[model samples]
Target: MSIAVAVISSDTEYVTRMMSYMKGSPIYHTWRLQLYTNPERIHQLTELERMELIIVEEHLHSSLLRRLQAGGGQLDELVYTSKRGAIPIIVLAAERRELLEHELYKFQSVSALLHGMQQRYERFRSGHAKKRLVTDDRQQTIAFCSTLEQAGKTVMALHVAALLASKGYRVFYCNLERWNTSDSFLAGRVLQEQAASYSDLLYVVKSRQNASKWLAEHAAAVEEYSFYMLRPFQHEADRRGLTTEDAQRLVAAIAESGLFDHVLVDLPAGLDDWTLPLLQQCHAHYMLLLPQPGWQRKHQLAMSCVERHNAQALEELQHKRLLVLSEPYGNCQPGSSVSDLESLPYVEAWQQGDPVLLGSVHYRAAVERCIQPLLTGEKVV
Candidate 1:
């Protein structure tokens, strides 16, 4: 299938020249391209076609981002609204980058820049779907979150939960990603009751009734990994309407029910409004940083906000905030002060739904160092 891509750039001259010569670019035959020098046209594309990749120029969303400034909305709200501003949205900047914010590849010639962009397009198409999901009973709840798209937060959560289950820990990996897709079918398909979904789960949690019966009767498992999995809500608004109270009641009841040893939560990239308060109650948090400054900054900000709001979350984050760094592009400098875990090795098994058992040297070492300690009967911290 041809990858559907939208490329937005503010520089007209660059767009003009590239549009003239792009037919010769490597992806002309293998992919479909839509070009715009303005971001406003995004709404048009969003309504017309489903984009596999969205590449927008830096500063295109500047006005929206202004919401993050001192007089505007706070960072979390800014990201919540903008959908991706928690990380300095990637930009096309020159060599000398500020705090390396708005970092982009610079080129002496337009051809070189286009080539780099094309390379990114190819890499993104090939590896983007590679992913996180969870929290625990042996210990307590764990959160998997990232600052930006394609940062492997889902992959880490799923792997950890699966690995823990492999060792006989009763684990349930839950997805709260908001965007509804049946990706869980890859984990395990269930003979679901037509009404089985977040809507039912929400009612059960909010009413404080019938959860044990519902879970026993309807819960599904990703068979080989031995961890339970839950799909997202049937309707988008159902998830959007989920409140902190709703999530808190749901996760708390699940964790305290003695049905499993741990519960792993797969959170959205920008902490959705619903995820904020539920976050305050988590026992441990993992912020996975891709090899980009934008990603690192968002991961740190997520940690900082959680700490500031919840005293207990802060204390645990101080000791258990997991900083996972992916392989570096050059030399990567992660600035978080919490405990650092090892970098993840990209395993081919991940795309096949078997990453839980991907026993790469670095992955195994990380599970032992970071997860083993919590698999006992104690909350992290």
Candidate 2:
């Protein structure tokens, strides 16, 4: 999904620099740039070529505002009444102003400028009641699952969540593993006086009540980790009655809450009523495989079961799933059967169960490498 963006600047050199930076960046594939040196050219853009965002120089912004005023219209009207609907216009100023909204310093790094544009665009879309042509506004839900236990699915998921949070994205991490031990690793203050447990959450979901409101009020925010999570279930039995519908509804509530940019779900090993729904609901699936023997056989058996129960779900998983080889150490080689899969470098220190190790510089670099494809919009075939 390429986002159409127009860069309107009278300075030809500035426009060229912006184009060069975007072409070299990881987001090149996701953003389609339309450069306009003459601000008046914006009026000539056809309906099909309408932009989702416009980056205009401060001087040109003033001219555009004057034009709007002459026509008995305001800048807000120009944004909401566009043929393509609700295009966010960002002003590129000479210097940064703390009180200014939707403004970016033009002389900053390309990455910083692009990040500001995205932030403002997101804020505008969320706050305004206007229609948009692009449909990528929904929060992304990514699930990490594996066929074998102790495959570092939870750890990897948390690391990825932390990485996104560090990039200034609001991330929500949900541990759906039956034997969830997230409490041991993520220790933080609960949001409410008495944090509502997963059982309470499931009950709200099952009753078809206001699950989003309940989650917003009860979800625990780990400030140190910079993410939100649900209180882990006290006992494995507490998750025994979680039906497939319940799982789907729970995930829907979280994603639709409009409170997070990404939702990371750490699913239990293997497919069942509970895990299958989550896999189906998630936008991307990271299936972790160990370099040990029988890994392929285990995955094959799991897919066979999924096919037998739900063929549609099986097809969806295949299209969005990324096969990952989980190595025990840095020098460990993946087995012949999984040699072609992407692998995560082993963090031997994490085995010590020190939660602080999860935030170590080395560990984050490993996780970043594993998830680079996701960041670059690369498809897994």
TM-score each candidate: 0.52, 0.62
Q: Using TM-score as the measure, which candidate wins?
A: 2
lDDT of residue 303 for candidate 2: 72
User: Over the stretch 3-91, how does candidate 2's per-residue lDDT look in tens digits?
Assistant: 78877788998778777887888678778887777556656445323777777788888766555445543356236244444567788
| Each prediction's number of clashing residue pairs | 17, 0
The digit string of per-residue lDDT tens for model 1 on 42-129 reads: 4432221354444455566464334235233344311221232112133465454452322346434657766655555444322221
Instruction: Go through the candidates in order and give each one's C-alpha lDDT.
Output: 0.58, 0.71
Q: Cα RMSD (Å) per model?
A: 22.2, 7.6
* Weakest 10 consecutive residues of candidate 1 by summed lDDT: 125-134
Colliding residue pairs in candidate 2: none
Off by over 4 Å in 2: 1-135, 187-193, 234-236, 304-312, 328-331
Question: Model 1 compared with the native: what TM-score?
Answer: 0.52
Please state the error at residue 301 of candidate 1 in Å: 6.1
